[model samples]
Target: MRVVGNYRNPGPQDEYSQGQGGYPPVSQPAPVRTEVNAGRLWAGGVAAAVVAALIGLVGVLVARAVFQLSPKSSSAFGDDATVQLCVVAALAALMATGIAHLLLVSTPSPLSYFGWIVGLLTVAAVVVPFLGSGSLVVRLSEAVIHLVIGIAIGGLVSNAAGSASRLTLGENR
Candidate 1:
């Protein structure tokens, strides 16, 4: 008998052949299962919120110091635009994280769907300011700031989803 890989070539007089000259079949491995780590996902969401707040703060600072621009005050947002922007940005980040989590569990291509949703939202944020009553420069500044915040939140949440996911072969189906 000769051994090759996992199969053996039985000789003509081999007793194990029992009138059948065939090798035993090899079994296939089980499929891999993927699971999400909620803790890591939330941690990334918190980090994304912090980043969004910082971006908001910097955006306001640059607009004020560099361009000598002042935030327009309205009854809806009150006098402190910086505070509002920061808080809104933080909340937006958290919301984005939730959306990412939902898509991760429900959608087939979660990342792709998340990207499209975020991109569309970012576009809406940028466009909404232009439609409102405000100076071109102020609107442009606000739009730019919103654009940056949206991008940061999206990227962070996506990365978190990827990191939080675990793959195991034949562990849990």
Candidate 2:
């Protein structure tokens, strides 16, 4: 109905002139996205721990099978094999956890990273006492070592959750 150029839309010229909103206004740039929630971090850490534990169990089964094919005697099971398997399993678990920390974490806060490293190492410490088959007291000491290491790892993991926090200790508020 009016004199116009050969075009259906105003094209790049309109875009250039009126800006995106069809008017010139002092534009506020978009805000940067920071780390949001701790849930993922905590869950991921726990998952790492659980997966490591499962692998350890698998090592136990493998050890039992390799050593005790046909049980001739109740105590015929080689303690050395059991100890090796547990130690190997602990190492494997911690190694996998370090990998998890490197891979799974989206936001790498220093505390989070430190906790991850230490927590994984604690799993390794859990197996130190099983280096050689020994007396019952020594074995019990090994377990005590494992327990202390586990508790320490748990504490370190708690620190991991402190980073990337969107929630508080107990409640969402």
Which candidate number would show the highest lDDT if scored against the true structure? 1
TM-score of every candidate: 0.74, 0.32
lDDT accuracy of residue 164 in candidate 2 = 37
Give per-residue CA lDDT, model 1, range 50-145, as digits (tens): 999999988888777667775465332224777888999999989988998887776677889999998999999989889999789889999999
Q: Residue 31 lDDT in model 1?
A: 64
C-alpha lDDT score of every prediction, in listed order: 0.84, 0.48
* TM-score of candidate 1 relative to the true fold: 0.74
After superposition, the stretches of candidate 1 with alpha carbons farther than 4 Å from their true spots are 1-33, 71-79, 169-173
Cα lDDT over the full model 2: 0.48
Query: Could you give the C-alpha RMSD of every candidate to the true structure, in order shown?
Result: 5.3, 12.7
For candidate 1, the 10 contiguous residues with the lowest summed lDDT are 70-79
Model 2 C-alpha lDDT per residue in residues 1-173, reported as the tens digit of each score: 22244323444556534546343333454543334344665564665455445444454444446443333443433345445645544554455445434433344443456555666666566666567676555455445545554554455444454453432233222
> Best candidate per TM-score, number?
1
